[model samples]
Target: MNNKIKSFLKSFTLFEIFLITIGITLVTTFSIVFGANPLAICSSVIGIIGVVFIAKGSVIGSVLGIIMSIFYIIVSYINGLYGEVVLYVLVIIPMNILSIIQWFKNVSQDKVTIKVQKTAKKDLIILAIATIIAIPIVYIILKFFNTQSLILSTFSIIISTVGTYLNVKRDKLTFIVFILHNLVVISLWIVTIINIQNLSLIPIIVNSSVNLFSNMYGVINWTKMQKKQNQKGSY
Candidate 1:
């Protein structure tokens, strides 16, 4: 039993464990103090963990991402963040699954390290066109549903769409997109918290802070990984 436990624990890095602990502690304390919805707190905790794993370039993160998307969709629905609900349910969940396949198919010889790719100009052009097409459609849906923080919510969908697309392609640009997404999300949640005047929303703020840190770390780490791949002529 001791060996089994140690082996299982070895699967995660020290930083990953630290992030998980912090997420759990924040959620637990906030839920106790603010009478926050336990489900939302739990979902935020899981989502933080998933983001940490994604920063490490692990396909397991994508699996966790799918689970996080489900919980986030539920939380967003209750909060009337219609754009968030649609983004998670319609885009994030499916993209996470696709990311899992892509990452797995691009692993190193050790089968543990996933290779990062670069985005081309054509990719940017395609994404730009897609964003232009998607914005109006998402705006119509959010407007119809009377979504909270309507403009911010619609903007989040746009950011998330670009971020997830880059992630699925293993582009190093994904972390940059995540940084932007995190900013938009922080603003979106802040508006919601102010409007509702609830301390319960504090956990979402904590979650976004952690996500911002994770994305910053991801940018640094993925850059190093890309350099290493380039050194080895791995493309």
Candidate 2:
């Protein structure tokens, strides 16, 4: 029985873990020249640390991801990547909070409650109406989604607020959602690299390594946290 446990525990050791993390941070630090503001670089470092240690679906990663996401999305928005901006803007805070709620209690192995279904038709219809209102209101309530930052913020808020109207919950479709989200993220990464013509291969390689290992590093953390949770059940 404990043999299985021992193998799991052996996956990490002090030196191997420390060495890998330092490498990631140092690489990310080098990425500073690639349009990352100081705030973003710092957030990336912190976010990496947070995610690597916390489980992907865990509360810690969620909160940290949410906080860092705002800045990242803002940067994207300013660059006129409006599509991703609209999608991410709505969930920066909520996704993080949901992550916290999903993992807050660990004893419920019989049921998991992470993913919720897509909004109901009525709710989607309301959301659609809100989106419609958003365009014209985007001009009035804000300044123009293009003209003023302050006005743009209002549109962001409007979009964020309406989605809050629902409370219907469902068990997470973890098996499907997890794989899908991962694949999509990987695709996004590929697209990012391809579109970024300014980056030399060396920088791209470094960035890739930083991102990959940091996430792997994050899983180590998630495992540690899970183990801690498991151990806490004992005296």
Candidate 3:
């Protein structure tokens, strides 16, 4: 356990650690300043930690992701973002579970990072078709639930589903999709805040903003990892 902790800590550079620390501080400060719910603050903190680990291709990220999703579900439920609740319960959690399993199976020589893969053309076609099919179905469901900002909810579902799917595939593209997903989420929550005048939800906005940067970093990190892996040809 001690060794594992050390390895996890050692996986990150000093700059990465500083960034993560800054993210946590900002999330906590935003939540407190905006009078966010305790759950929202917790979710934001966990989410920042989880996503940064994920950016590093660590299985620990998936574990933290599941926990963060649970907190997110409860927060979304209270705010009538039923689309978010359903998406997290049905899609995000399962994909995180699969990520844990797959990451473990594909661990690098360091035994901490997972091997990154480029999405194949066939997979891209399949994902595109799936996104098209899912959009209408998810829209209907969100409509039935009377979700707030229905259009935004539907878009969030599509983006998150595709992002998580790519994440499970260990594709570098996951972060790009997540960057879009975070934008949609930020918009969705901002709408909720305007509708209900609850400043507590601001932490989610802060969380997503932090996520946007983290995912951008994820793209850079994963691209480098993928190139290195390709050169080695060990996979």
Candidate 4:
């Protein structure tokens, strides 16, 4: 047991990478038949786990985080969660790149510990104000476009403000911000599924387009990020 612990302490671990990859792959493949709920669950679980694991200083965890990033964004996009989708495409994608760079630097330090910086009170206030701004944006979008239900639509806006802030800023606030936003999103999903209908092929296809993209992004980026990390570590 001592030797095992020592080995674990001295070496880099990829178990999380493999696990998250397998999960996302399964969730991606499964979304076709099981509908969007299961797919979104995969994304959510990946994100929550990724947040905790990354903070614990796992490179694989960071890789998994990128996967979650892509997964949620895509899921949001597909479910007519337009505002959230936009945040994914814009904020989340850029944040993924930053996370990769940050994690890579840590690996070079010959240590496995990750640092979660503190977030400022001012920043939290800014985030709250952003949410207030999102209200009008949500209102305008819903009014102009025939999007999904009001709850889901509004929730999408709220996530965009909070999630974007968390992804861009690496601090203790990230966890709390993610937790609160995810709860709201989960609530929105539960409400949505309560009235889910068996729609025709066309509707399903259009609805699932964003989800498919989300899975695709997570799988592809995770693979690329892991490969890059591995190569860097070897040198």
Candidate 5:
């Protein structure tokens, strides 16, 4: 365990470590200050940790993603975000599991970090059509369930599904999609806070904000990984 910790620490630069630390600290501090739900606090911290691993193209990220999703499901359910519940349980967790297998099969020479790929133009077109078709269908379902922030919840599922698919496919575009997902989620949580005046939802906002920055960093990091992999003639 200690050796694994050391290796993980060595994989990142000081700046990346600092950025991750700041994110974890911000979520924890905000959760305590706002007296957020205990589940939200757990979810926020685990989410920050999980996403940083993901940004680094590490398979361990997918494992953490599964654990984080459970906490998130409970929190969202309590807040009447049935869309979130369904999205995580039915889509995100399964994608993360698939991601673990995919990443393992597509690792770099080090046999740990994933070898990232660029999404093909044809696939991008397909994703666009799929997203359009999925949105209205998801919207109808969310409305039927009387999910909170109906529009935001529907959009979140669409964006998150695409993002999770890209992640599982090891596409570098995953981070860009997730950045957009984070924005929609931030808006959804903000609306939730306003509607219920629940201070506990503050941690969700903080978690999403941290995720936004992490995904931005993921874009840069994955671009570098893609270039390196191409130069090595791998994947």
Candidate 6:
């Protein structure tokens, strides 16, 4: 257990620590002020941890991602954010499982790092087509249910679908998709917070902010990894 704890701590860079600290502090304060929902708080924290781990290309992050999806689904359902509930339950959960399997298969000989892959042009085309199809379909469904922030929720679905697909493929483009997804998510939660004027939604706001930073970190690190791979190939 001690070794495991140390390993986990060693995975995080100083920048990651700073971002995580800020996210935790934001959530903690909101929880205290809004009368603590333990499940929401735990899910928020775990989700952030998972994002950070994924940024480092660790399989453990995918596992946490699956768990976070479950908790987030429950929270979204309770809040009447049916769009998020659908996304988490029907999409994110299953994708995270597949991601775990995919990452494991790509693990380095040392068994600690997962190799990132380049996105193909064909894959990009498919993602674009899927997003085009998904937006209207998701929008109609959310609209039928009268989901909160309907347009934004539909946008989230589009971003998340592309992001999850890229992520499972271990493409660096996933980070770019995540940056867009984070913005949509931040807007979605802001709408909810305004509608309910509750402190519980504050944690989600903080979670999105943390996600934005984590995605940026992922982009930077993955870029470095790609450059190193290219340099080695040149030799």
Q: Give the TM-score of candidate 2.
A: 0.46
On residues 87-109, what C-alpha lDDT tens digit does candidate 2 reach at each position?
A: 46655466556546645543233
Off by over 4 Å in 3: 1-4
lDDT of 3 by residue, 147-173 (tens): 999999999989999999999999999
**lDDT (Cα, tens digit) per residue for candidate 6, span 1-235:** 9998998788778988887788888888888898757878988888888898888888888899988888888888888889998998888888999899997777654467667778899879987887888788899999999898899888888789788989998889999999999999998888888997776767877888898999999999877766765665521
What candidate 4 gets wrong by more than 4 Å, as runs, is 1-49, 55-59, 69-75, 104-110, 198-235
| Model 1 regions lying over 4 Å from their true place | 1-14
lDDT by residue (1-235, candidate 5, tens digit) is 9998898678887756876798879877887788889889888888987888898888878998999999999999999999999999999999999998898788899787898877788998999999999988999999999999999999999999999999987887889999999999999999999999998779888888988888898999889888888898887
- Reference-based lDDT, each prediction: 0.85, 0.46, 0.90, 0.53, 0.89, 0.84
Among residues 3 or more apart in sequence or in different chains, the pairs in candidate 5 whose N, CA or C atoms overlap within 3 Å are none
Better of 3 and 4 by TM-score: 3
Q: CA lDDT of 30 in candidate 6?
A: 83
Query: Would you list the clashing residue pairs of candidate 4?
Result: 74-214
What lDDT tens digits, residue by residue, belong to model 1 across residues 23-132? Answer: 77877787788887776787788888888888878887899899878878887888889899989988899999899898878985546557988888997998899899
Q: Between prediction 2 and prediction 3, which has the larger lDDT?
A: 3
**True-vs-predicted CA distance for residue 210, candidate 1, Å:** 0.6
Worst 10 residues of 3 by lDDT: 7-16
Model 3: per-residue Cα lDDT at residue 151: 96
| Shift of residue 29 alpha carbon in model 4, Å | 15
A best-first ranking of the candidates according to their TM-score comes to 5, 3, 6, 1, 4, 2
Better of 4 and 5 by lDDT: 5
